[model samples]
Target: MGKPTGFLEYKREAPQKKDPFERTKNWQEFQLFMPEDKLRQQGARCMDCAIPFCQAGTTMAGSGEIGCPVYNLIPEWNDLVYRGKWREALDRLHKTNNFPEFTGRVCPAPCEGSCTVALNGDPVTIKSIEYHIVERGFQEGWIQPEPPKTRTGKHVAVVGSGPAGLAAAAQLNKAGHTVTVFERDDRIGGLLTYGIPDVKLANEVVERRVQLLEAEGITFKTEVEIGVDITAEELETSFDAVILATGATKPREVQAPGKELNGIHYAMDFLTANTKSLLNSQLADGEFISAKGKHVIVIGGGDTGADCITTSIRHGAASVIQFDINKQKGAMRSGDNVWPLYPIIHTVEDAHKEAMAVYGKDPRSYMLQTKAFFGNQDGQVTGLQTVEVTTELKNGQKIRTEIPGTERTWKADLILLAIGFTGPEQELLQQLGIETTSRTTVKAPYGKYTTSKPGIFAAGDNRRGQSLVVWAIHEGREAARECDRYLMGSTRLP
Candidate 1:
C-alpha cells in the first residue's frame, strides 16, 4: 500500500463532466479526465479489507445478489495503480477482463457498491482508474497482439462480435485455436459498434480492439448471416466446435392503439441506424431519423432510453420526454435491497442531465402509461395519448390501473421505444433447431454452455437474455473454457 492511511487524507474525486448546455450541442463523451495525481489519490482510497467482496463475484446466499461477475481483482489493481505501477495495473486488469475500456466506460460499477469504503463515505474511483490504466496502455504501445506460439489443429467458430464473442475469440485464439467470428452487420463489433451511442463509447475504441484481435490472427467475417447464409449443420461439419454468441437482437414491442405508425421505431433500430449512417455515407442520405427541432417522446426508462434521450438532445431536439411505467426509485438504498447488493436508486445519467439543461425540468415522468399512439393523415405518429396509472398486486398477479380523469396528450414527431429486448431473434435460432427456455433464451445450463446437441455451445445474451456487457464477457469466457474442454477433453483456460 503506497499510502495506507490515504483513504482518510483524500476526498473522493470523480471525472468532471462538461456543462450540460455546452455538452448537449455536440455528440461526444462529456466526462472530462481527472489529473493523474488526483486519480492516484483516488486509487489510494482502497482500504485493506480482510475479505474483499468487490472481487468476490459470488451471489449472496438466499439473496442471489452477486459481486463483479468477471471476478476482477479490485484491491490488487487499486494498490498497483496507487503505487504508480501503471503497467502492472494493466496486466492485473487483463487477467480477468479482456476489455476493460468497454466496461470502464459503461459498466454500472457494482464493484464500487460492494466496496468496504462505500458503507461510510465515498468508495474508491475504481472505474476511472481502470479507464486510465487501459487508455494509457494503448498510448504507451503496451497493448499489442499476442499471436500464439504453437498452433493447435483445432478450429473454432464464434458467432457475433460483441463483447462476449470478442472475448471468446481472443481466448480461443490465444490457446492456439484458429478462430473466426461471424457478424451479420457490416462491422465486426456487434452492439459495441451499433447499439451503444458513440457519445458513450466512440467507434474508434471498438475498431482499435477489433484490429488487435485481427492482428492476433482471428479472422472476422462481417455482413454474413449464420442461419440464412450458412447452415448450422454446415458449421457443425466445418468447425470442430461452434460457439453461439449471437446476442438477443429481437426488440420488445409495445401494444398500443396505433402501434403501426411510420415515425415509431425500436430503440435499437434508431440507435443502430444513427451510428451506421454516421459511419457510412451511403446510409446517411435520405430522411435520417432526425429529432432536430421536434419534440421527442422516449418510452422505457432504461439505459437504451437514456441513450436515445442523449442522442436526440445532441441532434438539436426542441424537447424530450422520457416515460417510465415503474414508480420513481428512492435516493438511498431500499430496505429490500441492502448492503453488498446492486442498489436500485434514482439515477440521473448523462442523458437526463442534458435533457434537463435543454428543458426546464428533468424529462422523466414516473407512473406514466401510454394509452395509445395517435397518428396523422399519412399514418405517421404525431402524439402520444397517455394517462397516470397506479400499480397493484391482485390475485398473485401484478397490474396497472389507469387513474380517472388523468388522460393527457403530448406532441411528438419521433417516438423511440427503448423498452428492453425479448430474447434472441427466433428465425435463426429456430432454423438451427436450438431449443429455447420459457423466457425464450437459448436453452443452456449455467456455467456449462453445452446445448442439446453435442459440440454446440451458447453464451452471452443468447443464453442469458439481454444483460450487461460485463456479464456477456464473463459468459463468453466461461463458454470458451467449456467448449475447449469439450473439444480437447481438457482446457487450461479459466
Candidate 2:
C-alpha cells in the first residue's frame, strides 16, 4: 500500500459533469477530469485488499456474478496513481484492457461493486482514474503504434469490427499475423461508432484508436457484408483462420397491435441514423429521425432506453417518458444483495438526470406494460395503450401478470422500442454452416472459441449473447490465442 492510512483519510471523488440542462443542447461529452492532487487522493482511497475482488473476474453465486472480466490490475494501478507514476499506471492499465478509454466511459463499473472498501463505505474511483491514465498517456505521446518485429506470414480475417473484432485483430497483429477486419457498416466501429451516442463517447476518441490500429499494420474493410459481398467459402479459402466477432444485433421485437405504424421505430434504427447523420452532416441534411416537437415514449428501460430518452430530449421533444416492466427497485440494497456484489438498488443515470431537468420530472414509469399502439388517420403513431402489471413469484421465476382494470392511454407521437437484442443475425452464421445453441447464439463452448467447423472461431456477442465491452475484449483476446494455436501449433499470445 502506498499509504497505510490512505483509505481511512481519503474519500472517493469522481469527475464532475456539465450541468444536465446545458449539456443536452449538444452532442458533446460532458465529463470534466479531476485535478491531479484530487485524483491522487481518490486513488489513495484504494484499500488494496489481500484478495481484491475488483479484479477477481469470476462468476460467483449471486447478483453481480462477475467483476472485471479483463482482470485489470486495480491495486497496482491504484498504487502507481497514488505515487504519481501516471506513465506506469497507463502501462499497467493496458496490460489486460486493450481499450480502457472506451470502458472508462461506457462500462457500469462492476469493479466498484466488488470492491472490498465498498462493504462499509464508498468504493475507489477506479473508472475515473483509468480514464485519466489513458487520456494522460495520449496527451504525453506515450501511446503509439508498435508494429510487430517480424511477420508470421499467416493472414487472419476478423468479422464485425466492434470491440471484440478490434481486440482480436490487435492481438493477432501483435502475434505477427496479417489481420483484416470486416465491417458491414460504412464506418469502422460497429457499436462504438454508431450504437453508442457521441455525448457519452466522442467520435474523436474512437477515431484516435482506429488511426493507431491502422498505423500498426491492421487493415479495416468497411461496407463489406461478408456473406453477401463475398462468399464464406471464398473467405475461408483466402485466410488461414477466420474469427467471428459480429455482435448480437438482432433486436427483440414487441408483439403489439399497430406495430407497423410510421412513427414506431426500433431503437437501433433511431440511434444509428442519428449518429450517421450527425457525423455526415451535423443533422443539416435531414436524413435522421426527428423527435422535434413530438411526444416520445421509449419502451424497455435500460441503457438503450436511456440513450433514446437523451437523444429525444436533444431533438427538442415536447415530452419524453420511459417504461419498464420490472418494478422499481428500492433506494438501498436489498437483504439478499450482500457486500462485494452489485447491489440491486435504484440508481440515476445521466439520461435520467437530464430528463428530470428538462421535463421537470423523472420520465420513467415502472410496472407498466405496452398492450397496443394507437395511430392517427395518417397511420403515424399518436398514442399507446398500456396496462399495469404485478409481479408474482411462481416456483423460482418471476411472472408478470397484467391487471384488467388498470388499462390506460397516453399520448405518444413517436415510439422507440429500446428493448434488448436477441442474438447475432443468422444469415452469416447459416452461410458459414456453423452450429448454434438453443438461444440462437454461435455454439462455441465457454473458453474454447472453436466452432463446429475447423478453421472458424466465434467470440463476443456472436458467441456469448449481448454483453459489456470488457467481456467482448476478453473473448476476442482468448479467441485470438486459440486461433493462433490452431495455425501455428503452439502460441505465445496471452
Candidate 3:
C-alpha cells in the first residue's frame, strides 16, 4: 500500500458540486473536479482489507445486495492513485471496464456501497478517483486507440450502439475481427448520447470515445435500423456472427386513464428529444417537448424520474413533482441491511437538491400513485389525480392498496412516465427468429450469450433486462468473448 494507516489519517472527500441555483440555469455538468492532492487523499482511504468486498461483484440471495457487476480492480487502481501513478491506474481501470468515464459519471457506484470501509466509516471516493484517472489519461495523451495488429478477416455486425454494443465492438476489434456497429438513431451512443441529460453526462464525452473507437478501426453506421432499413437476414448473411446489444427500450406503460393525452409522454421520448434539441440548436430549434412554464408531473422515483425533474427545472417549469408508489426509505440503513450490502436508505440526488433550491421543498412524494390524467377539451393534459397508498404483507407477498379519502388532484400540464423499461422491442428479435425468456428478454445462457439461432447472440439490457451501464459493459465484454470463441474456436480476449 502507498500509505499504511492512510485510511486513519484521511477522511473521505468527494468532488464539489456547483451551486444548485446557479447550475440549474444551464445544461453543463455541475460536478467540479477535486485537486490532485485531495484525490490522492481519497485514494488513500482504501483499506487493505483481506477480503475486499468492493470488487467482489457478488449477488447475495434474496438480499438485494450487489457488488461491482463489472468486477473492477478497485484495490489495484486505488493504490496506483494513492502513489500518484495515474497513468498506471488508468491502464488497470481499462482492463475490466471498456468505458470507465461512462460508468464513473452515470453508474450508481454499488462498489462504494459494498466497500469494506463503508461498514463503519465513509467509503473511499472510488467513483471520483476513477473519473479523474480516465479524464487525466485522455488529457495526458496516455489513452489512445489500440488497433489490432493483424485482421482476422472475420466480420461481426453489432446491433445497437449503446454501452454494450460499443464494448463488444471494442473487444472484438481488439481480437483482430472486423467489427461494424449499427445504430438506429443518428448518433453512435445510444443511451449515453440521448437518454441521459447533458447535465449528468455531456455529449462531448460520448463523442470523444466514439471518435477513438473509429480511430481503432470500428465502423459505426448511424441511422441504420436493423429490421427496417436492413433485413435481419441480410445481417446474418453479411457477417460471420451477429451480436444483439440493442437495449431494453420498451417502456413499461402507465395503465391510467387519458394516457393518450397530448401532454403525456414516455420518459425516454422526452429526455431523448430534449438532448437532441439541446445539441442541435441549443434549444432554438424548439423540436423537443418543451416543459417551459408547464407544471410537470413525473411518475416513478428512480434515476429516470430524477432526470425528468432536473430537465424540467432547467426548462423553467412552473413546478415539478415526482411520485412514487413505494414507501419512502429510511434516512439510515436498517439492521437487516448491514455492512457490505447496498443500503436501502433515502438520499437526495443532484436533481432533488436542485429542486429543493428552486422550489423550496423536495419534489418527491412517496406512496402516491397516479389514478388518472385529467385533460381539457383539446385533449392536452390539465392535471392528474392521485391516491395515497399503503403496503401490507399478505402470504409473504407485499401488496399495495389505496387509502380511502386520500385522493388528491394536482395541476400538471406535462406528464412524464419514468416507470422504467420492460424489455427489448420484439420486432428485431422476432424477425431474427430468436427465442425469448418468459420475461421477454432475449434467451441466452448465463455466460455463453448464444441465442437459440446460431451465429446470433444477445447481451446487455436486451438479455438481462434494464440494468446499469456498468452491467451492460460487463455483458458486452463477456458476450464478445463468447462470440469470438464461437467463430474462431478459441478467443484470447479477456
Candidate 4:
C-alpha cells in the first residue's frame, strides 16, 4: 500500500513522448522518461484497495479479469518506488516478472485498468513507474548476474529465443539446471530481435538482457533450427526436458485475386528486413527496402498495421492508407466500457499520430474489405478493389454484409499484410506428435502446460497463440516452475 492520502495528493502523470514530426524521421523510441520526482508522485497514487484486483492474474471469469498477467505485487512495488526504495521495488517486480523493462515498455498495463483510482480518474502510472524502477536499478549497478552457486546435473533445452524461452531459460538456470536455448535465427531474441521494429523496442535492450543470461552460464545457439536442420529426435535424446516457446509466427494472409503480386509483403518480412538492415549497416549501402515514393496500403488495423504505417512514413511513402474491417470505436470511454476493463476507445497511436502530422489526416478507413488485388504485367501490385461492409450481431453471431454501391478501387504500389498471426506453425508440432487445437496452438491443459509428449512442455505464443509480451512472460515463468517440479519431484523456482 502507498501513503494513505497519496491517492488524493497526486494526480496521474505518464512520461512525455517525443513530438511526432521529429520522431517519425528517425528510428528511435518515442517514450520520454519522467523525472525521478514526477515518477515518484505517480507511484504514490497507488491506493490501498481492500481487495487488490490489480495483482490477480487470471483470465478465467472474474479471476484474470483485472491487473497484470504476471500477477506482479503492484501496490507493494508502487509503494516501494514512491518511497525511493528503488532496489527493493525492483526485487518486488522481479518476484513476479523476470523482465520488467520489457513489460514496462511494451505491456498495455491491464493492471492499471484494474486499479481502483481508474474507476473515477486516470490510473496510477504503473507502467512508467515500472520503467523508472528497473532503469534505476541498472543505473545504480544493482542489476547483476546472479548465477546459481551450485549446479543441478539435469539439463533443459528451450526451443525459440523469444520472451518466453528467454524467461524460462533464465529461471531454469537460476534453479541450477544446465540450460541451453536454441534459436533458429542468426540472432537470439525471436520476435523481439526480428519482428518488432527499433522504434518500438530497441534491439540493445534485448541484447543486454540476453547477455546477462549468457553471463549466468546459459548457452544460446543461434542459426540452429530444431525440427528442420536439427531433428526433434536429436534434442529429445540430448536434453532431459524440452520447453517449446516457438512463437505463433504463421502470418494470417488475405487471399485475393493477384495475391502473388511482387509488391505484396508480409508485415514480418518488411519489419524484420528493415530491423536487420538497420542494425547491420543502417541501410548505408542502400540495401534496405524503401517505401519512398510509393503509395502504401496496409491491411489489418491492429498494432502491426500501425507499425507498417509509421515505418512507411519514416521511409517517405507518398501516400499511406490503412484498411480496417471493424467499425470505428468511440473517441472516449463508453457506458459499456467502464474503468478496470481496457477502455475500447478510438485514439491515434504513435504511428497514427505521426502519419497524421505529415499526411494531414489519419490513414485508417473503417469497415473496408479488400475485394481483389490488381497487378501489372511485371507481376507488381498496382491497386486493390474494395467494398465497404457493415458489421452487425445477428442472432448471437457477428456478421459482415457488403453495402451496395460502396465498391471502389484505390491505387497502391506496396501492400503490407498485417492481419495478425494465426497460431504456432503446424508442421513442427505435427512432426513432434504434440497435439494442437483447431486454432493451431499446442494443446495443453491450462496452468499444467504439459504437452502430449512426456518431458515436453509448451508455453507463450506457442501454447496461447499470439498475445502480449507480459502474458508470454507470465506463461514462461509458470511453465518453468512446472517443468522444474517435473524434473525434480518438487520445486521452489516460482
Estimate every model's Cα lDDT from 0 to 1: 0.87, 0.92, 0.92, 0.87
Per-model TM values vs. the true structure:
0.96, 0.98, 0.98, 0.96
How many pairs of residues collide in model 3? 0
lDDT of 2 by residue, 1-494 (tens): 89878888988778999999999999999999889999898888888899998998866643555468899999999999999999999999998988999999998888888898888889899899999999999999999999999999999999999999999999999999999999989999889999999998888999999999999999999999999998999999999999999999999989899999989999999999999999999999999999999999999889999999989999999999999988999987888787677667799999999999999999999999999998978898899999999998787678989988999999998999999999999998999999999989999987889999998999999999988888898999999999999989989988
Candidate 3 differs from the real structure by a C-alpha RMSD in angstroms, to one decimal, of 1.2
Model 4 quality (TM-score): 0.96
Q: Which has the greatest lDDT?
A: 3
Across residues 1-494, which tens digit of lDDT does each residue of candidate 4 receive? 65888888987777999999999879998898788888778878888678777777755443234578888988898888788888899999889888988988878788887888878777888888888888888889999999999998999999999999998998899889999999988889898888778888899999988988999999999999899888988889999999999999999888778888899999988988888888988877666667999999999999888989888998999999999999899877777666566667787788888888999999999999899999888999999999999988777577989999999999999999999999998877877899989888999876889999999999899899888898889888888988999999999987
Candidate 2 lDDT score relative to the true structure: 0.92
lDDT per residue, candidate 1, 1-494, as tens digits? Answer: 67889889999889898998898766677778778888888988998678887877767644445568899888888888888899999999999999999998999888877888888888788888889889989989999989999888999999999989999999898888999999989997788889898888988999999999999999999988898889877877899998899999888889889989988989888898888887776335633588889889999989999999988887888889999988999999888677777667898888888888888789999888888999889998899899998988677466999889988999999999998989988777776688899989999998999887788899999999999999999999999999889877899999
Residue 435 error, candidate 2, Å: 0.2
Q: For candidate 2, report its TM-score.
A: 0.98
Among residues 3 or more apart in sequence or in different chains, the pairs in candidate 2 whose N, CA or C atoms overlap within 3 Å are: none
Clashing pairs in 4: 58-64, 67-111
